[model samples]
Target: MADDLRVDRMTEKQAREELARLAELLGEANAAYHRDDAPVMSDAEYDRLRQRNAAIEAAFPALKRADSPSEQVGAAPAEGFGKISHSERMLSLGNAFEADEVREFDARVRRYLNLGPDAALDYTAEPKIDGLSLSLRYEEGRFVQAATRGDGQVGENVTANARTIGDIPDRIEGAPDILEVRGEVYMSHADFEALNARQAERGDKTFANPRNAAAGSLRQLDAEITRARPLRFFAYAWGALSEPLAETQMGAIERLSELGFVTNDLTRLCDGAEEMLAHYETIEQMRATLGYDIDGVVYKVNALALQARLGYRSTTPRWAIAHKFPAELAWTRLEAIDIQVGRTGALSPVARLSPVTVGGVVVSNATLHNEDYIAGRAASGEAIRGGKDIRVGDWVQVYRAGDVIPKIADVDLERRPEDAEPYRFPETCPECGSEAVREEGDAVRRCTGGLICPAQAVEKLRHFVSRAAFDIEGLGAKQVEQFFADGWIAEPADIFTLESRFGSGMKQLKNREGWGEKSAENLFAAIEARREVALSRLLYSLGIRHLGEVAAQDLARHYQSWEALVEAVDLARPAAQAHRAGEEAAEAERAAAAAEGRGARVSEARARARSERDVPEDAQAAWDDLVAVDGIGPVLALSLSEALANPEERAAIDRLVGKLARIVPPEARAEDSPVAGKTVVFTGTLEKMTRDEAKARAEALGAKVSGSVSSKTDLVVAGPGAGSKAKKARDLGIEMIDEDAWLALIGDA
Candidate 1:
């Protein structure tokens, strides 16, 4: 938790700064987990950061940014899948972290209903399955569609994949003609283990947890891949219904079970708050023995009438609350502190701890986050761990909650060594001996050594060859590390020259300690196989911060050719530079006009200067065109421009490109496609495809995907939750279509 950033004591300036940091942190976390399926932080850490953001926003509402994570839902749908807008929004639940909080939830619900202190309330309590949320839609009692809970309002259309899950009833008689059953798609413990074993046998990727396994399986583009996985589902709620299934929540669950849906057997009817807590405890106790994972218990007001009366708050329903279990903690010795450099050169401090068990996982390391965390101070200078500094040889409490990375909770002063001193973070990169600088407003201290830092270089090289990137066989993490250490490979381009340099030499790689003749040949063949790669893969392998797989694909589709993309980047450098210079000059002119006591004329002068100093038409067009592409905003554009402009980086990229046989552009969109050559912008919540996926699909059909609506936009795909973009499109007289219409236009309907 950002417990150290005391919201109540924060100044407006501090609150604003903290809010921005929290927004970026949480937003990245959401994207990593939801879109990339590679989470950098634990759910607990994410929740804590979210809670901190909420606290800061509450304390300084006037300073809240428009894109505050508090206003957002899940990560935007990734590209490649068709989107599905939900008939009824899949809302998340409010969390109660303790029994007292759970009691307070009950009290709040009772107060909302105007119930007296002695009044009793009935609730339905069940385990909150730790799995991917799914909504199954049935038309005329026959399953017709299934979707993920993307951003609550819109999800990915995974109907074909959902059909493979045995627990889902393809046809349900005696149910509403139009029904949407909402629950979780999960992998049981046994199934997860078996699946992992199979993956290992096949030398494929293994899942970190059952939840991720289930989600990855269900989201497979190829339904056959999803069908090969063992997946199950449970019915806990209903979305749209032609008729009411029952009058109460418990009754509805029973009806669902009767309709061939698998409902949790541990679900119980609680007479009051005490019974609900009891059931929560019961579930918590049985969590270990259960076949699947569950992080908490969900308690809902049993009466459907009461639920309707209670209604929802901004994000979650007031009638229902999730009582989350406390994080598991264990005492361990603080062995040492180590700073690790990430791809972006951020120096993260890790606590090297004596091995300890927390929540069935053995953890020997914990995250200290940054200098402030190590110093036990919040950004606002508030003390965490009661001002106790974690020291080497100290017995510290480490905790893990909901599959999050282990973190130090507190230090036991009683067990601290007398000779222990306060740990000092390094001022230089340990690997390169270069200055490590912490920029203003940033929690992380980055290495100024840049690519020269071996730590950063190795990390980036590892990322370049990661499974999602090059996926070069025989060149895994260990191999990458070994080659980098031995000076055999220092960058991506070096891999292509490996065989030519050492294949037939007397000191060939075949004569290395771990390499045999056959293994060396296989490695060279793997490198050769990847010499002719796709433009998207080549761009993604560069490891530019914030340029993910989805963004790379978007760029590939937009530019169509590797040469065109590089030329555009080269053009964008001067264009962006000119734009910045013009903006600065305009600001200066405005200031000079104000100083000259020109009141109303100051605005006029500013406008004139802005227009006169405007970038050249070609330059402006290049910059505007770059930003106009869907998912390619100013931040990413800046990174790409800077990377391509830097001499060393540009040379590296050029070398790599020169070595490649060819960079295959994305497949051209069909000439006969309805949306071909049209400019389309997707706004609000998309039901059929995620915004990214929608953009991809449009681009696939030879349509130019724009992020915002303009007069030039030929069509606007507005979904259920569309807001200002839709209004702008309407005002501009742009043709509008729903997600269904867009899907039909793409011939996917």
Candidate 2:
């Protein structure tokens, strides 16, 4: 489906499928941009896709995927660098594309703080730097470590490389004993040009843009390479401070500058949305002359107190937003169209374009989304781009806004070649000659080839070793592809037997074109290191549909062990299938009744379907328990059950499990906390904190917070306007308390 489709017009099935596609697309985009420093989609297109995902989620809240892009930050840290867990999460800022969005942001701040329109609120507006995010840690006023913002919670250590930058201060005279300065590491246009020229002169690959150059240069394993690069820093934020920097945002920036750290000189203090927008315009006007790349303007609540009160969401801060500039457009010729199969067997189309410079980067390809998109219609049959279909040999307008690759914005039909014909989308998988089918309510066509398709097999193997999964140090995508082609590592279990199979023989890895003895040994050691993996990592590495990092973690936490999880899934499978069958039958009955003009029969069929779905009590209970975990709805639960029930998949899983040393459970809960190991529920309005804050605090205290009141609930904390849940708690005779009493009980009051 086109990302621009209206959420209200979409059916629930369409919304679910779109969300899954967006999650996969955005996940890949995040990895490309953050981990590899090679983005595959334009920033504008990325933002639009995220917005569409969010809108669909909001429209159908229950249908939201556990791996929704809205809840994710940067990709996991790339291998080769030692990892660093941030003292505080390095969150991404929310974006505002229009003037109204900026205004809405301000209004949201006011509402959250319970302030009116007339309240005196000020903001700090600065250029949103287009570069890599870095965090510098200092203890006793001396620099100690620097890290790249990998995923919000963890990062890649680059201390030695960071020390090579001239702008970074090795020591500060008067600062907090422990401080973490957060900012952007950027390359100026002049420096980037010189570096690229030097690279070209030396017969090395030139970087695409200043941002990419800066990121690649900073992440280099060799500190000398980073020293040679002319990278600059602009300290704008701080994390994990022993003492407060200042009372306000502007004051903090001033303090940072006083400490010998380079801060953005154009940072300005503004009051209200009007002034913020004015500064945004001023920054945009000066963008070309700034020397450094900045894609937008950032606005932060000036008062630190307000910022603290506003708090943060899962992936972004509520107290700040990035007001993004519009995309830069350029005309390019569409040369051809190509179809690529993803791990999920979706046959995605790509538009090959004649090389053109867009936003200082050369563009050769753009995502076609799906066949519906190429045909100029959304899944709902809505006309997009004025009903102009994209074709090979047509002149297309491409645009770039942020870090990713450029995208085709519009087609110039007048410039189309006379002999160009409408492209025929293939009905068969190009890689395996298998039937490619588009299921009902699905926009993208997928191959039915399964593991037989090399493309799908390779992509799945790549996902299994991705940074967030197994993450073997020397076993990356290239190696996985090579091994797959050689038929030495066809499945997850095959990976564990590499050494025994080819360690010392003539056909060993060390004998390969690029491999040495040391490298081969290192790869073997890395694989050995992952033998005793965490249950969450193991689950994610399986490449199950709809089971992402977060969902896997959730399941791992609930099930605790691999054996326990498999048992639960096995017990729940029968009931899950029964329920699905009943639902499908009910849907068919409703459609037939509606077609025959029997409205009463439709309601009767739905009631009968619900009765027919009733399975044995034990099986139904097991299915209920499986779905009871937060974020594990019927869709994800059913997918899990089906995956485990498949003979081929289950056999592979069992083989992989047999090769492992152990699957570690999650860390133990906070034993000393008052709510440790207890399930708690919160209801109605919270006066002292937001619901999110309450939930976070509860979880931090080792409590299992539930969304609904049930027999398992140990306590309920009800506030003003408490209704159904509060009543349910009372009816069940579960212990209940008001917000104040609850706080006092937790020793926070």
Candidate 3:
């Protein structure tokens, strides 16, 4: 695993960038796992990413993105099936990787409920199945509908496909008039192996694991295909109910069993966290013998009344948590190491290994993270793997939990070949022969070739036309690669000029291989349709670092037009440069002071520089305005300003903008709402709701939620324990209100 940034030492800028990267990576992972039924990364890696994201958010709460991974349950439903709107949202469970975390979870629950330390709390522990989540709805004793857990609120209707599963009863007796049963749709190990053998015999594609097979089988478009496959369902939860099922979690599972549902037999009721951990250990020991895949053990508060009081976070239940198991390990021989350049010009190292199976998946390639990882040191100079550097032709231990991508866990130096030598990382990009430079705080070395590098150019073009960008109908990744290879398109602007350049004549697109008259015409039509796009999409399509979908939307809402945004960037460039210079000077002064044992002068130097810096008032105002745009921070603003200041980048953007018909601004704000168009700051602990809930509510009411109290702030909501921010609000004379007053204001709005 890669060495993660320490939450305590991470700056707000780094936090914002890390959050953006996690959002994109986790979004893709969710789509692959929930919607496509083929996970791209392992379960441990996914859990690690989520944990890192949560830690970062906790450290810098105001930097959370609107589309944060912490608030997402699952990916949106795939296209082929009909969509079903779930009556009650199917939320995800929080995870615990260690015994202490489990104990902390119990303590948190007790704290939230204001119970004494010796309060009696019972929890039901059960194995968390590694399979697809399905919800079966019954109306008046008859199973009326079945759907997959897709993006929580909405799912794909799989009624016909679900009915074929033998474990799911068609009707039930002694059940509520309206009961929505939720459970896992899975395939046993024996069934999965047998199914794979049949698939191989028929020369069809084999599954990677039992979970994938179960998901693939249950989501089949043809009901007959689903019926031919072996699938099972375990009932453990419910969504909507007309009446109470039971008084406790254990009683509810028994009710589900009596209603003709197949419930897992390993379910047990535990007294507290310690008992829960014991049950988890028992389940872990029985995992291989259980005949089904279970990734972790889930513990839910037993009392229904306590659960009702606990309620939920935005995407997870507060009354339950899954204590996940560790990764599975195997040894493999490292063949070679390769560096691949990404869209952002990052040169990432990958390890090619001899085939080995770990956690039921065959592994041949693993991420080396960065050059520092290969050198056996973290970015902060901490020794890892006992300072054992990785070399080619060495034996390495690989681990995988549930992710498709496995990682190297350790190296066996004794098994290394005598001729093996320390690997040398390239200082130049292999593709473009350009110098690769690693920035001071950055972990990866990036190519300096920019658009001149073929790899970066193709990747940028691909991103420009990605699903969330222009999304031209016939211009997929393969098309982009082919066009770039033929020198037909080299940049985003070149995409908009395709028809005019190759619609006819000897260089025509129709003349190309695998191209027909209709297809070529359709491609041109698709490109034409994207001539007009939303402002946020256009900004995101530029592939700016730290500028994600949410950030782009925030920028769009603030600037409203391309011209306005460009002008602001131009005006703010000088002020951004001055700020950078001041920071650099302060650092230099501190270093000099430390070397001379004159620590007292360090503060004076920094204060003098801040008080004497020469920056135009207009430019400073422009910089302040840009940074005040809710999610936009100094780091992101500087990146954007520098991009526009670059000659080549500016020209490319200009050319692309020239071809656009119109750039639509964001929707108008709700003028009637009291908080609409106002910049609001939240401070201290919110008693009525969580901080995230308050931020969401404010944004929904058309108000901008700033992280800190500023002169532009129109309102500040201060709760108990508010300190610096509350005083600042009072000093600035911003309208200060309590949590109840805030609730009243929004309620009346």
Candidate 4:
């Protein structure tokens, strides 16, 4: 059934069947895991099935049923416990399986905030304990009630059971009048083993895992029973607050610690995605030695204001994500190698492995990344295989985490077959017979056939209507494929004309097999709704190389209008070409002069190209302005400019642009404040406002607030506890101001 649920390539009928099967399996699993405290399925298995269900639904949107398991969290509150309704919802964080996804999460927040690529976004990374989520409500700094995160919106009333936990304070002082602290309650491994041993001695049932033991102990009907168990709590977040706790996430955690609530000591402030991932790896390495269970590392936007601006999605916050560690690893035989073509024509290799269970999830396929990965070499030319390359018929270690695709970890040369030969990657796309070439400094082998390649065309079309694109309600990947196969739509521009062409004809979409009258109408209406899209979405929909969501937003913010962006790209293209040609000609002249022993002439030619004043003023300025946009560095700028420069690409874009009603520009921040665009850093303990408040106020006043002091730092606000950053600012001769000075500068003194 799991094998049959590869819904990415499944037909509509197959998707319907798989969704129905998944719903049934997941419904029972939820009951067993949440209600009965006896899980019939592993966490890995549950996550995989849920992922498959979501994929199937995404492909066949019309077939999505309301009772879908993907819409659910934990099971409804257990029968015995009283239910409590939360004022503010307790949502879960979306999972990131790989380092790139974590980086994407950070970039996404920056894009939403319209920040420069180089702008620092501080993050609080902490251990994601594998325990039941508990929300404790306090009134006037006194603990009033506590509840479990039963189904996000409502939870079981475990206040009586919660009081027994020693880590939870009966009352907190110097806190907001109305505060609701949310955190995890778990039983340590030692405590769990001891409790189980005691239960065995008393001829009672024992728990399977620490998480289960903790949940069962907390949800017990007898309060005394829960009081006897060693259940601990770690406060990390909050719900409804009458007054703000702290300005930043880390500050709030610190305040919680001061109020006598236990917080994870491993929590630290991280600067960027790389630092966050480094901390994640550190936590993963120490996971086995930790006294309690933690499945992953959770990263949240440190700035409370930023977190507020990047608000909640349907069931998760957009500003935070959890990076789950690999759940399990298993050795399996590499059955074969397969090549898959992406929307961008990149040919990716996949490893087909014999079915094996890793983390209780059956994996028959794993991503080989690219050709270099298969040959035991890193993309950066580093050795990875330790003298044992992966090959067909070789035993390979496969690892799985969260719902991400399995990956090949290592190869067992001891079990390799004698007759196996080195695997050769295809020089042409398997879907279409086209020449595949790996670009310089790139690991991927891409098809050069462009639109002629069916794989690339279908994938691009599918992407055009994906959630992050046009997001037509009833038309999904499967629908897009169906329409493409029927020749109803060939390009994005064709979508806008769909109704006029086929809305009332004999070839109308309603007459299609899978589509009904309502669904067809819904799809057409959705398409029409997106006729006027945001400039950022339009740029992202183009799917240009290296121009991701973040880059598109940066470009959109820089060029406020669609016409401005198109004109700029058109103008930048020629300038870039001229600049590149000039550099090449200069290099050639330098080489020729050096060959002839004319050292002075060679130096002069090099200087002409290198000097700012020697180049065409307009061309140089255009290039400079293009790269000046935050996040749009030289490489990305070149790709964007060239993509717009291509005649065919330009023609298609023009057609698409003509069809749209208008491109909405990003909202501009107020720039009347004196501190607008000034880079300011605050250090030490701020007295007038919380660190979060100060950052938010500075940002509101149009200042670019930085977390650290650097040479580029314009001003430093040193508080009473000023430290190294203040010293650095002083050393660099940067203006040092106090809180009062900052207020005076902002004209609030």
- Report clashes for each candidate as comma-separated counts: 8, 0, 6, 1
Of the candidates shown, which would achieve the greatest TM-score relative to the real structure? 3
- lDDT score, residue 455, model 4? 87
lDDT of 3 at 256: 97
lDDT of 3 at 307: 98
Candidate 4, residues 539-607, lDDT tens digits: the string is 888878888875876788789898887777666665677555555566666667768977656565555
lDDT of 1 by residue, 173-248 (tens): 8888898999998888778879989998777998877878888999899999999999999889999999999999
For model 3, residues 208-283, the per-residue Cα lDDT tens digits are: 8888999999999999999999999999999999999999999999999999999999999898889999999787
Among residues 3 or more apart in sequence or in different chains, the pairs in candidate 2 whose N, CA or C atoms overlap within 3 Å are: none
- Model 2 RMSD in Å is 18.2
- Provide the global lDDT of candidate 4 against the true structure: 0.82
Off by over 4 Å in 2: 1-206, 210-327, 400-406, 505-507, 586-614, 671-749
Error of 4 at 698 (Å): 15
lDDT of 2 by residue, 419-467 (tens): 9898889999999999999965679899988778889889989999998
lDDT against the true structure, per candidate, is: 0.83, 0.86, 0.87, 0.82
Q: What is the lDDT of candidate 3?
A: 0.87
TM-score of every candidate: 0.49, 0.50, 0.51, 0.48
Question: Model 1, which residues run further than 4 Å from truth?
Answer: 1-3, 329-517, 520-749
